[model samples]
Target: MKKINLENKTILVTGAAGFIGANLVLKLLHEVSRINIVGIDNMNDYYDVGIKEWRLEEIKTKADDNSTDSSWTFIKGDIADKEMVDKIFSQYHPDIVVNLAAQAGVRYSITNPDAYIHSNLIGFYNILEACRHSGDDSGKKVEHLVYASSSSVYGGNKKVPFSTDDKVDNPVSLYAATKKSNELMAHAYSKLYNIPSTGLRFFTVYGPAGRPDMAYFGFTNKLLKGETIKIFNYGNCRRDFTYIDDIVEGIYRVMQGAPDQKNGEDGLPIPPYAVYNIGGGRPENLLDFVDILQQELLNAGVLPKDYNFEAHKELVPMQSGDVPVTYADTTALERDYGYRPSVDLRTGLRNFAEWYKKFYID
Candidate 1:
């Protein structure tokens, strides 16, 4: 693999305390020298703040390595705050901006729609504006803007393997709607302002220090506490679970391969924007996934062999904003970047189980 140079480049990563954001930040610091990273997160009580703090501690430990003066700065602020965003942009003048901050969770969006509007809508708008105008006086333009989209954008489509060309106008939940809106907004900005942007439709991302609200993490917790775990959709659903390391690698490749406008029927460059589905192409059955997870937990000493795992399993109807199955068509990603997520489900689950045992159980 050829190394892409990020030396002396200042990068801004929003939602830096989140699962994916923290992992990406650590990878960048490890790969680049003379790099300065500015991470912004509100530290909301969405999940455990302890996980966020632990992620920050990991970054700090890496930053302290004296071999490279790569500095990591954390800002406790909301991205929706225009003043704070503008101030940070002015201060850092980042060469690249990765926006991962958003109101996540499908069920949560059903009850609290306002939170999605505030963070996903308003916060994203503020970031785009800042990126557009940040270089006016400083003469340091944002080279690329990469943002997170979700597989939920596929909604209740009948398609098996979702593609970027598929119509995503029919979002099932407010969370999905906001993510689709982000892609549209990014396209418009890319067209009007000539800003290069790429939106990544991430599949079910699960790994160490994962989000507790996700089914896998939540199920683990419920099983540990001797509570019934809700197996929605009668444990018949399938998910394209992509590990965190693969996701970070995909993002790093896409960051370097920023889209460019091309001549269209109008004889002008089409918008300098693109979208890709980042997922493990393979889909695993829900029941099989749980079985593997249970075995892994027992092996890690987090669960007892005599534990009544079957008694704790409850098959329930599918909830709103949930899809039966999600698979990704990684043809474009592999063709363009020569990368594909190859982490097997069992391997990924084992890693997550080990992390959970060490972090929460021990």
Candidate 2:
């Protein structure tokens, strides 16, 4: 593994306007004085495009205030388009590529499976192709390729803390299958093209300005509308809800340390590839999570102190593709990168409560 200096490097972050992508891009733009960041996103209305636009606006402001105007560039394009992806790769010649763009959500994949095939499979293949050809006829080469996977790949594993070493062959949801496929595809590309790649299996990530489709965001919206909020699996599920900032930090460190290069006895470059889970490690029950969320909302004035929380709660059966628990074994992440996502639920939920008030209520 090589330690990289962010200064004077050009990085390509797909889905730059999306939740995690936007946050990662912001950090790079403001923190690294001399780095060039090229972010590409289709800005699809998978959720509200308003939030995406808001993140982009914040990035622009950060660039302006930091006087790093030349360091940030955003392209409104879809990764599924082969020509568009090829064009961006050829034009930017980015030194590092972080692929975060994908059709996210498990339940959404039940009826809308085609979206997953287009974005997750083909889109990812296009990236692999671009990275494979990035060094062709050019002096510049992509130093690393870091892509997002999901803990959902664990599927119905009867394990406590899911480890990357565990077999993820049985994916219950289309979303999980696609994510697992991504890891396999990346491995093949890395081995054949000698591209250094790392795949991140993210847990239930939640935070301010997150995807509205997620349970946390959906629950808040429903409660605000005075509607019943469904508690899936009869409130028996537990999740390792990781915060966005901690996820970004984990990604930043992983980017700097690509898997060590290896060669076979025949001297052919063997792909240096690795995978790890990024999560809080502490699994919080859904009911307890909601309790904290309610308190935080009250504390932040997003909800009235006298709001009838019990009236809005509705326990329901587990939907298809749902699991009982998702606990991450983050030992590898901590051992390799010296970082672990340990943000307490209360602190994280409080931050979301405050942000929710400012964004929607205020």
Candidate 3:
């Protein structure tokens, strides 16, 4: 592995207003000094634009409060725009680039396939192109390019813990397909350009200020409105729920080390590329997860103690483009980075519930 110093480096983070992106920017500002951070996001309304704005606001507040000599510049644009991407590359000349700007959610991809293609496919291609050209004219090359890939790429695999070595050609949804394509595309670029890239296959990520479309957050919103929350696959699904902080920490560690650039026997680049799964190895049952979430909500004052939780839930068949379980085998991540997700489900949900009370109810 090639270690890249983040201090005094220019970093570009796409999806700066996103759940993970904003939090990551905050982490960097707090930890690294004299750094230049550039962010770009289209600010789409996939869930709630207000939440996205709120996350950006948090980043701004953190930047102001941070005593470190770090600077942040945000650009409102889509990565799919080749001109904008090129301009950013030329202007910022970032040493590290984190691509997290993509249309998320499986069911939404089923209905809105165009959004997936536009963002996941074309946007990723644009980023790759920019990375490819970053070394032109003796300019500083991008030391590392880290992008987000989803565990959905596992797609109905019967394995208990999905490994990076597992075949992921059978994507059940367009979103998964796009994420898989990203890995392939990054590998090709790394081989051709020696860009030193890494892809992280994130498991079910959740926590305070998370996406509302996720099951835990959505259930809370529905229960608050006295609406029935559907438990998919008759409540038999299992998920390796990873907390947002864990995810960000994984990204931060992975960013500092890029795959080693080497030469093959044939005198060609060996493609400094790798992929790892960032997840809590433990998979929790959906029913049990909901029960814990309910208790947390009550503890956080988002729900009354005497609320009839049983009446508010309905078990149903699994929806299309949905998997019965997502269990990540993070042995590679742990072995490589010496880090694993340590946040428990109950604790993560409690944090979310408290944030919900403060943001929505308070």
Candidate 4:
């Protein structure tokens, strides 16, 4: 794998105002010096645009407070627009591109499959195409293209620990199918264009200031409103609930290490591509996870200790496109990067609870 030098490099992060994207940009700006980051997002109202705007503000605050050596530039545009994407690539000529903008929600995909096709497929294709031509007219080349994939791609796998090597052919939801297609598309692009790419299959990512669409954040919102929180699959399911900080850490490490560019004896580009599961290795049961969340909420004063937890929780059958379990085999991530997501549910929930209290309640 080719190791990249972070100094004086321009990194382009799509979905920069989004949850993970904003957090990733904040981390990069704080930690790395002498680097410029260009962020692109259509800033569509998939959820609360207010939160997205707030995150962008937070990034600005963090950037201002942190190292003076780093800088950030945000462009309000969609990657699916070929002209917009081409313009950004032409303007910045980013040495690295992290594609995170996508129509994210599995349930949302049922009602709107076109969003998935437009963003995940076409948007990603434009990114690959941009990277393919990035080196043109300029000596600067995109050394790495790290993109987001979802554990939903594992889709009904009977396996306990979902390995990257697992066959993800049977995607139950349009979201999963799109994510799986990204991996396949990345592979083809890597082989054809030799664009070193790494796809991260993220498991249930939860943290403070997170997506309102996600279960944890949504549950908090409902509980605060004295509404019933639906526990799908009768709370029998399990998930590798990775925290936002851990996910960003994994991404930062992967950004520096691109899959080794090697050629076959046949003298063709050997597809410098890799996939890793960035997840909590320990899969916590849904009920247990909820319990931890409740405790943390109470601890953070987001919920009273005497709050009627049972009254707010509604255990229901699993929704279509939802899985019974998602367990990640982080052997490859650990072996290669010497790091795997280790944040426990309680600890992670505590952080979220604190953030929720500060951001929403307090």
Q: Identify the leading candidate in terms of TM-score.
A: 3
Question: Clashing residue pairs, candidate 3?
Answer: none
lDDT of 2: 0.92
lDDT of 2 by residue, 1-362 (tens): 77777778899999899889999988887667688899999999989999999999998888777765447889999899999999998898999999999999999999999999999999999999999999886868798999999999999999789999999999999999999999999999889988899999999988999999999899999999999999999999999999999999999988888887789899988779999999999999999999999999999999899999999999999999999999999999999999877689999999999999999999
Candidate 3, after superposition: displacement of residue 241 in Å?
A: 0.2
Estimated TM-score per prediction? 0.96, 0.98, 0.99, 0.98
Q: Identify the leading candidate in terms of lDDT.
A: 3
Residue 86 lDDT, candidate 2, scale 0-100:
91
**After TM-score superposition, what is the CA distance of residue 33 in candidate 1 from its true location, in Å?**
1.6
Candidate 3: where are CA atoms >4 Å away? none
What's the CA RMSD for each of the models?
2.0, 1.0, 0.7, 1.0
**lDDT tens readout by residue for model 1, 192-293:** 777888899999999999899998899999999999999999998999999999999999888777776456797765777888899999989999999999
> On residues 1-362, what C-alpha lDDT tens digit does candidate 4 reach at each position?
78898879999999999999999999998789888999989999889998899999999898778765888898999899999998889889999999999999999999999999999999999999999999896867799999999999999999879998888899999999999999999999999989999999999899878999999999889999999999999999998889999999999999999999988999988999999999988888989989888989899999888999998888899999999999989889988887767677888889989988988877
TM-score of 3: 0.99
Runs with alpha carbons beyond 4 Å of true place in candidate 1: 1-4, 261-269
State each model's CA lDDT, in order: 0.90, 0.92, 0.95, 0.92
Rank list by TM-score: 3, 2, 4, 1
Q: Which stretches of candidate 2 lie over 4 Å from their true place?
A: 67-70
Clashing pairs in 1: none
lDDT of 3 by residue, 282-312 (tens): 9999999999999999999999889999899
